[model samples]
Target: MPTPTPWYARIPPPLIMLFAIVVFVAVMTYVLPAGHYERIEVAGRMRVVPGSYGTVDSTPIGILQLFRAFPEGYKVATPIIFICLASALMFAILKATRTIENAVGRLLYKLGTKRAELILVLLTFFYGLLGIMVGYENNIAMIPIGAVVVLALGGDLVLAAGVSAGGMTVAFGLSPINPYTVGIGHEIAELPLFSGAGLRSVLCFGALAITAAFNVRYFRKIRRAPETAIGRGLDERGLALAKPLDEYAVSGRDWLLLALFGDGLAWVLYGVFNLGWFINDISAVFLVVFVVMAACSGLSLSQISAAGMKGIAEMAPATFIIGMAATVKVLLEQGQIQDTISYGLAQALQGLPTYLSAVGMSIGQSGLNLLIPSGSGQALATLPVMIPLGEALGLSRQVSILAFQVGDGVTNLFNPSLGGLVAMLSLCRVPFDRWLRFVLPLTGIILVWAWLGLLVAVAIGYS
Candidate 1:
């Protein structure tokens, strides 16, 4: 008799999982009520009127449109897809030059395995800090570098992805100064911009501590017992084992290339913060970095072209999944139930007590993130109602915003509908099931922290 397939074999791959979900949501388009809300422009976003929801003619997507959503996802997700492909191509060319390998080798030579955990801690904090300051969607290129460093430090790809994406996810959730989420939220809630920074800073620090401690503990665990990691057989820390430290050293050319890489990133950051650059601008910078670095590394033109193609090929799986994830969003919008769901969720909070209402707002936001993953979009749609609802429940608008912050922020860590999360995990070769196993526990703990923080905010009359 043939051997049985493993239990996980029954589960669909990430791409298939997304396809199934998109189909399910497409079906629900017919089943769920269709509605819309009147909107007014505020702070460059369309804010929903608090009491303007009305039933509209049902507009469920047909089978043709359902199939069309996949291609639409590709079109809709193009910007982030560009960023993802660019990062992959750049790293592939960098690998051709052995820059990452030699850099990890030199660092290991100086730090040894025992001391490398510090690098994890610091990188996590650095990423967390950048996210706190810069918001989201600008750091896709940098995460792989952190993952590589972690892989070199004797952890599996899961841990590598964990510390890098994990830290950034946390910071994005609790970002006090983020102009997109918190700033837009503040403007919508009629609060001073960055007004509640003190409490938010504390919340962010406490959450990062929890994340860093949990990940570092796991890092130490697999260090001593590699069998225990979810990625045990799937990943390896071969930087030290691939060759002796003595055999690997950073050259003058590597240093110059490294500096150029830093300059490229600095330029991207400048464009993002100063010039309002986004995906296209950032992708252009990465492409330049790849071409320049490949030239400096002395690869022939054909070799350079091959490396770029190979990088895009390697990234195809993740890139495809990212596009499919967008299909779910497209289907949701196509059905016209997006605002109906938002209206119903808001209506449910009408009679709850102050504390429960605050918590409920966060819960509702988390649920809505499954539908509306964009922070600014969610804020515009939900906060108009949530703020007033919280005020009616004897809760401050600040508490409601905090609830939105935590609810909106933490879900990105593993929300499959959020393309960035799935894309990052796929790039790291972490399966969706394994990612949930690792992140769900932290997600639960962070939700609790969010609840407790909300309670404290209410107790102190936070405004």
Candidate 2:
């Protein structure tokens, strides 16, 4: 076994990426623009610009210079800040009402199963399927509760965490209706919102189905594996970081939750009906829902503000990590890195025939997802390059779409930089090594499922 690094030497993925960005920026000062490159346009649901890069300027200065130019990177990180604040407030409110705990308790009690291994598999399926409708952030909030369920069932904590993490990724990965990232992928690839919906839905459903089957097999092994298989007994130290289950109010909180749920419904309707309310300003919808939750919860303005602040604090680390990720976007934009990657991969697979391009694309997309954890951002960077290549190679737009979704969703299972993944890890106190041991097999299973979906897509006129 590889020796684990000491605590002090363990570097977070965001920090490692940031260091790479700094080095890339420093080097770009000398050899970019003059080197082989392409003019890139970044258009997606979200965009990340390193302050070090000039605003569409033709200047030759390194993007690193822009970092110094804008010292308050927080200004550039506004969305991240808002997201963090909202998550923390949501968590606080959920805790204050004990609604989450009560809900989880009820779920476990109703399960009426003595075999924990069976329940864990079922939980993964439920959560993963629910994710098709809700965002990963919403679904991940329930993971810690899943941990308690696991502990009670005598299953491994790490395995339970994997169930949540892995399940959530498979759900979002295969979702035909991901309003954020998939929407961005469609826009960048110039596919209609309804363009590949049928095939995409099929692929998504297929991935989830296969994921469900594989998790069942894996958890069976987990149930049989001795507790000693886990190096350190599952640590519940971070349970302290979570508000007590009783703190979340359930009865009076229903109205608040219902309102929030309705708000979420309205948001979904706006997407489906193409409502002008959503078209004019989507952010306004999030704000309105937030306010409604406060009002229904009977929270005073001060209490709400305090909750929001707490939520922001909890999410502060994520904010910095996401902001640093923006710097990597800067490097790719300036260096034509996306094009370079696309071209190199395309050339290497040139002799494999057209069907293979879709395969290569799926692999490339999965790999890029590691370096750029955000699906929206990755799609924006790669789709234009990949879609056109796929078209030229006689592949359908649907294949590109399915390929992108599968690639984006699979890597999400363990990427530490992703807000939901990191939050689940923290909330559950599952260490990186432990998370890996449990998830790697499942991830491999999902990867095979992804390719199988791609092959099906090819067979069904997608290629």
Candidate 3:
């Protein structure tokens, strides 16, 4: 018999967590004094002044303001939610036509059992490369597809998220061409653009390879022991889609759908690479695919409409979860306590030795991610102080950026406040505690990886 879910875990974790965090942040607005730092425009973005912290008029979230956070969070989360709904609709159409089942069936048939482990590894590497190529936030839309793929493969959503978001987290955080943290870090440090690429490239690839292996191992474990699945009362819809090897048959229609999927992705990638497309733009492209695939599968207009709505309905709760996470950031910003917290965290690193200071900078960056989820925002807000501090402690500018890159990326893997991470988990129906249970050890391993990398950089006087 399946273990009964605890009373506390019965309510969806995001709703409970959102309520708790919303109230907690609201209370904090009153408890923590409101303050901010001076900002000066540089290259079209405002950069924070390191020592210009000053008290501001307190704007605590009273009862009225506290209640307003949800709508505001929805507002902040709307664009990503839209993208998610659109992608879900597309996948729903595929599911309605059994396109996904056939594709996975063909894959399992072709790969056989021995080579099946490579699926998770390849997907992790592919998504990690997407993280490096396009940018991280934009890839949140792809999480659903990854979920469906893994679900059809009979793996749970925890592994789904581990493959999709985990790949992005490791590679995007350490990407040499990140253009957000590393890019802005270089700008603030007045270094050449994308300088010190060798070390970061090595770290990114090494981390990606390690993450791929981790996810593959997890997949194999659950395949062997179904009782070990992390998602409680796990949805079994996907597991039923896979047919036995003897029943495998890949038809012409399945081949057509496969080509269409590849074609849609290629178009989206082109837009991301050359057209500067973001979430809304990607959704438009997917909506087009949603239409094309429906027409190709001989889905009637009524059938298309029904499948599309079903998909959106299936994803509706996930949209709210994304908003709830976004709400945490919105409330923090509204409280005007963001800078205060940033300044406070930065202040703690003042007297640490060079190596520990490097580690501290990463830790501060990780903690600060909860407050300022954006990579560029974090680099702008914290690098001014961290850079000089690292230099004063005899570490180089590149090393400072490395710490920011790793720290900024690490917390993102598990931070509930991050909409992208939360969006992925909610889409997969994996609770936050479950994610922590699965990822904490990996997070620790990566954290130590960053610390050791920083130690080596400082020891060799890496520039």
Residue 208 of model 2 has an lDDT of: 67
RMSD of each: 2.4, 6.2, 3.0
Name the candidate, 2 or 3, with the larger lDDT value. Answer: 3
Best model number under lDDT: 1
TM-scores, each model vs. reference: 0.94, 0.72, 0.91
Error of 3 at 248 (Å): 3.6
Query: Candidate 2, residue 442: CA error in Å?
Result: 2.2
Candidate-wise lDDT, in order:
0.81, 0.60, 0.80
Error of 3 at 139 (Å): 3.2
Per-residue alpha-carbon lDDT of candidate 2 for residues 1-463, written as tens digits (9 for 90 to 100)? 9998765335444456555654655465455332232334554133322111222333443545656422334454455445444545555665555455555554555665465656766777777776776566544445656666665555566656656766777788778888666777676656677466676676666666666666556556656776444524655532322443334344657655755845664665556456433222433454565666767777777887877776556556665655665555454545444444544555565555667777777787777776566676676556666666677777787787777778788878766546557656655666655666667777887788678778878877862
User: Candidate 2, after superposition: displacement of residue 128 in Å?
Assistant: 2.7
Of 1 and 2, the candidate ranking higher by TM-score: 1
Model 1 lDDT tens row, 310-421: 7788678888878888787788778888888888888898899888888888888998887677787788878887888788899888888898888888888867777777
| Residue pair clashes in candidate 3 | none
Predicted candidate 3 versus true structure: per-residue lDDT over 1-463, tens digit per residue: 9999774355447667667877888899999999998999999989888778899999999898887888988898788888888777777777777776776666676776566577778889999999999877666656766776677666787888898888988888888899888889999999999998888887788888888887888887888888887864766574345567557676887778767877888898899889878888888887888778888887788988888888778777777877887787788889999888877877787788989888888888887776567787788877887787778777799998999888888778877667677766766767778887788878888778768888988888889
